[model samples]
Target: MRGKYTIKEINRIPELLKKGKEYKITYDKDKKYTFIGCGSSYNLGLITTKMLNKNGYKSNVISGGEVIVFDKVPQTDIGIFISRTGESTETVKAVENFKKRKIKTIGITCTADTTLTKVCDETYIFEFANEESVVMTGSFVYILNFLLNGIKKIDIIKDAETVLSKIKEQIDTIDLKKYNHYVFLGYEEEYGISKEGALKIQEMAIQNVEYHEPLEYRHGPKSILNEHTLVVINSKDTKKEAKLAEELKNMEAEVILIGKGKDIDIPYNNGYETPLRMILPQYLGYKKALIEGYDPDQPRNLTKSVILD
Candidate 1:
């Protein structure tokens, strides 16, 4: 089951979302929040932080390693640590630093009864979203939806089904060997989605990838655009982003735009729909890995969790 678990996990995103735990924890709208995680979980925090701040909830994001190594935690009323496995060393240990500051602590993970649950003031365990693959996939979307939608009737499952159905044809037909350079573009919360998208390709296909704001690419990064370059734009449904997509296409780089009436039907929805955009890149990564003959189940130099001594 080299690529089997990866495929299975990605396809089961809707099922996992259906099983997500509702947001039962009380929150203080006036309090400041800081989210901590690593890799995909970090990206999740980034997206959530953007959404939270935009919606008038004061929030920021930090990496667990920063707290562990630099002791640099943003002064916040709450520290929300996220880890898929609930046992990431930096995230687990970083809790103490926030606790020392007398900050309220929260933990979010897929596995239950792990160190995170024991250490944080509160823990959210999405046991249904747990996966065997080292790389985070369905669980990422599940947690993101939980934090954002909170078991709301958002119909993310339907959006995901639509994306996966359409993206399969588009991604499967691509010659993965020809595309050596990949770029992801977005703004605001979508930028975090772009980061996660680039990461999916990098982890599965071992490709050189970059992510930037749409206009930022026009700076110096556009110099790398070529026929071998593939660009994915998580559009903000703005004219400027659309124009950038057209410019990149004219430059002969393949472009995928996920916005209203774009390559993918799901609109930016002010970043609420950004969770569905994740499916496209995930499927693309899986296909590219199969093309590269690497087992998507096990990526190079990665483990299900990072447990430092």
Candidate 2:
């Protein structure tokens, strides 16, 4: 039962997504949106904001800590708070700030009867995507796919099982012990996915991880590349990104590209397929944890929710 929850949750993603399609989630085209959350939820907000902005909506993201401590709530017509448990203190408090200003609020969580649902103007709960593990695996992809579907119908759900199988095969062939440092690189929405990828390795495998925009790696970050580093690039299929991957490979770093015609080879369906790309890191992190003798279900010094007093 060490990694039971993580594996179960990851395998449940396709089922959760299929159910998400029938969920009555709503979005407003006329309103500007601000998303607030912490950790995995915050990283999700980043991907959501990028997707919304790219699809002709005005949206931005901020961490719940910023809203509570620095009062960094931006002026926007709508505020969306995301929390897996819906009871994270900073996230609930941030929603309260939005409520005080009379801004329309939305809560996206995997739990229904929680503090977030009680405060927000609207709440969308996907309890099926909820996890028993401290680290988020399926719920992250499920919620992100939910938001992406709200913006535009995501057809990738049909291919999720196939994608997961392929990723697992690729991961099984790689020797996890060979790499000590993990780096994830992407651009825009993919950059957020890369950040989440890095977090997954750090949390579950307890390894050194870094994330940067594909080209940004050249700006001093490349100096640290070595034979023991494994770089996962969430590529945009751009020539520059491809060249960078080649350069890193030549520098003796292992590079796995997750875009058209690359290592993972998932079609970049205008970023709608971004959720599928996440399976790579999720499986990698889980496998790496097993290799390192860490429990992926209960990552060290972490919890299911951050309920600060």
Candidate 3:
């Protein structure tokens, strides 16, 4: 499943954007909802909740396996569940519970026939190549695209589509074999993406990496800086990011900055509106992993999805 999205499949993001805009009006409820998932899907759940808020909808999160044990569930309005594969039992069970409560459910999954889809009221499937490995790569990006495009407000799908296209161009040409260790930094909502990017490197490249808040990095995580480490900072302020880059430079750490402004001489610099910008590094890191002889489709010891009773 490495490089599962051909340039063509990846390019369909623009049309997906259009479809999202068209379908956006279909969802007009501003009521409360819950998002469910496990592992990587749980990370996606966090992002989806943020998007729901941005679109004027109230939402909360509950781990898939613990839904029953958690506090009283909200009356279903717009339940969102994410799973790269549809069969994760926890997510499926959560969907069943939501349905029993007469909650409106929307499923985001990779497979069309998975249990989650079968139980959901509305489902969106990303057509990614089958992942041979336990870890997910292209499927994650595909789900991300669904979120970025599906949200009608904040209205920047076209811009994001353009940014992703340019990112793909840069990805196709860059040589990532130069770095051994990586550090991912993001403040606020983007921090989850930094964590995901760090996980990708750890799982695929078998490399050393850490994800920390930009400010937190200053407190202690900066000590590991060295030429072998790639310090990737996700920030909106380039000048502030440059200051951090300067610190990394002093420590001989290679710096890669992503976001707005002009502080550091960022590699693959591009502006993206809102938190969707965070997804770029996941795409960038995935490209790096493939070049490094790691199969993202099947990370060393991961499963398609984590299932907990």
- Clashes within 3 Å, all models in order: 0, 0, 3
Alpha carbon lDDT at 206, candidate 2: 98
Instruction: Please state the error at residue 165 of candidate 1 in Å.
Output: 1.2
Off by over 4 Å in 2: none
In the order shown, the candidates' Cα RMSDs to the true structure are 1.5, 1.1, 4.5
Candidate 2, overall lDDT? 0.90
Give the 10-residue window scoring lowest on summed lDDT in candidate 1.
18-27
Give lDDT per model, in order.
Answer: 0.87, 0.90, 0.65
lDDT per residue (tens digit) for residues 1-111 in model 3: 574543333445445445544333234456777778887778766666665665676767777878755634666577788877888888887787787778888887767
Of 2 and 3, which scores higher on lDDT? 2
* Candidate rank order under lDDT: 2, 1, 3
Pairs that collide, model 1 = none
